[model samples]
Target: MTTATETLLPGTDIVLEQLPKVSLHDHLDGGLRPQTIIDLAAGIGLELPASTAEELGAWFAEKSNSGSLVEYLKTFDITTAVMQTAEGLRRVAHEFVLDLAADGVIWGEIRWAPEQHQQKGLSLDEAVEAVQAGLDDGVAEARADGRTIRVGQLISAMRHADRGLEIAELAVRHRHAGVVGFDIAGAEAGFPAGRMRDAFDHLAQSFFPATVHAGEADGLDSIRGALLDGRALRLGHGVRLAEDIEISTENGTSYARLGELAEWIKDRRICLETSPSSNLQTGAIAQWGDEMVDHPLDLFYQLGFLVTVNTDNRLMSGTTLSRELALVSDAFGYDLDDVLTLQLNAASAAFLSVDDRETLTDAIIAGFEPFLDAEDAR
Candidate 1:
């Protein structure tokens, strides 16, 4: 049962929170409950900008809304600070899954850089293990509550750091455990994925899947490196790829011409893990406009790009997958079919095996059937 606070699909009585959703770009550290942060901070002797949960949540939201990716990223210092110990990582990971489940996410990939959580002597492997344990606990708890949710770790390496190869190996070593894929994130403008060629090469040789953070803080060149060097299966916040598209108005009709880069991404069906609220907060969509309507997500969808909506940082953005979908629906006038298409796109792009992907796709279709039937009846 969804609460009054649950987001409803625009122009429909259906609760968006009850829809089957898939999250591909959510951050474990960025999804913690504000009270959990306070509790963990007290244990670790860390000072936070706000004391109460409400204030802390608002502080994160305000700090993240600075409209600069750099400024938006500064809020992570507070989040990652409290996530040093195994206990802290576990609790945060556990709660992260529960939150995703509560938001009606049936499958989610929680991405985070393990190297950043070693301030308290936890090894990289230990950090991954701790998070996996927490995810497992959360899954069990969710199942007990009759919520079916599955989660995987997308272990990330900081782009500004030189530990890409090391992190890649760690991710591969734990593939059979809870880790699903690998990624390179953080400060995308200067540090291109080419810098992590060795890591990508290793992942490719090992036949592991990867998604590179590109086209968010950078442009086409960065996205090119992600595909060419990193061999990314998906592009994280690939919103800027829209820059390669030229829209011109001739007569009363407007047409879009795709550049070679945009053409290739579109032709190949590479997934775009777009975070609507976080994209706005980070100024990722400022080139088009500052409003949700200005988001190229609708343009991308109209052009048949494999786009999936996500909540990059729920705490900072004060959003959920359901909320992200509802925002896009409201902005683009997307109905139930559009929403289902987005979920299907995400299900297909998930780092699961072909059979697993089919299973997920079936589950998503099944979940949306009743709603679609109800819409038809109406």
Candidate 2:
């Protein structure tokens, strides 16, 4: 597998890892370094399926490719198990930021369920604080190494569980700390965002931001629930929103007709946090096809919907933000301009103040300007 630093844009001298990027939908429990998992599991007296980092990484990748979201989610059992304690969470959180910085991600949101990590006796607040401490350490370390990166926590409530209200409060409580937003994940089919109406209402009243995992495991109704019930600012893995678009070709020309929901999402520029590899693995895009090229990301982008590329789980997908961008570029014949547009979309959709978002946008544009100019001169 190619590391982010080694992956280059197709037919270009530009390295993908050198490009400034933003990640809005990454999962914390899903991004542990394989070696860290082995060490943490050993300290916790837990037995792992694979003894070596390479083998363990392979195990996650193999299991995640099961083509079922439920089955794909099973791999998190091992990862979350090792992260039950404050120490484990801290180490994993620290390493996660460093890895993101290494991959040239300037800003990212790491989402995870605190309720799941309470198995080791850490309170939800304690767990959030531990992760924040580690994030702070990672930021300091990266700065010491001359790399600039910023990250925030997106507290998640398991959709299958009933802690939505509790988790929403937890996120709001930590808003001034490291928590930036709220989310609901796990088993998205039957459990619509409407189930967590009270949580969303609380967040709305508190003026907190949220991003709902929708249009991946379910259809348009799920997306509707996300917008109307969850009041999400962004759609996690909203790739399946393509279903609402009717496509037809006429005399060698193609046209796309948007449904009401699609038109609203498009007109409003609600960010679609699309993960190409993870979407394929979870069979989220199976209805369309099983290949990266078949992903409706291009279609959505062509239609002017706010689309941002992400790696839902770095370890499970054995991918980086850079790798995801490279794959999409290869699939859709995208250039630096497309890459810049995607980063800008993510920057605009981030749960930050308008001023902060503008700063991030300026940084991304500046990073891409040199290469874009070079491309223009070519």
**Pairs with steric clashes in candidate 2:** none
lDDT digits (tens) for residues 113-156 of candidate 1: 99999998999999999999999999999999999999999999
Compute each candidate's TM-score over C-alphas.
0.99, 0.98
Sum up the clashes in candidate 2. 0
Write the residue-wise lDDT of candidate 2 on 220-288 in tens digits.
999999999999999999988999999999999999999999999999989999999999999999999
Q: lDDT of each model, Cα atoms only?
A: 0.94, 0.94
Q: Which ten residues in a row have the lowest lDDT in candidate 1?
A: 1-10
Clash pairs, model 1 backbone: none
lDDT of 2: 0.94
**For model 1, what is the alpha-carbon lDDT of residue 127?**
98
RMSD (Å) of each candidate, 1 decimal:
1.0, 1.2
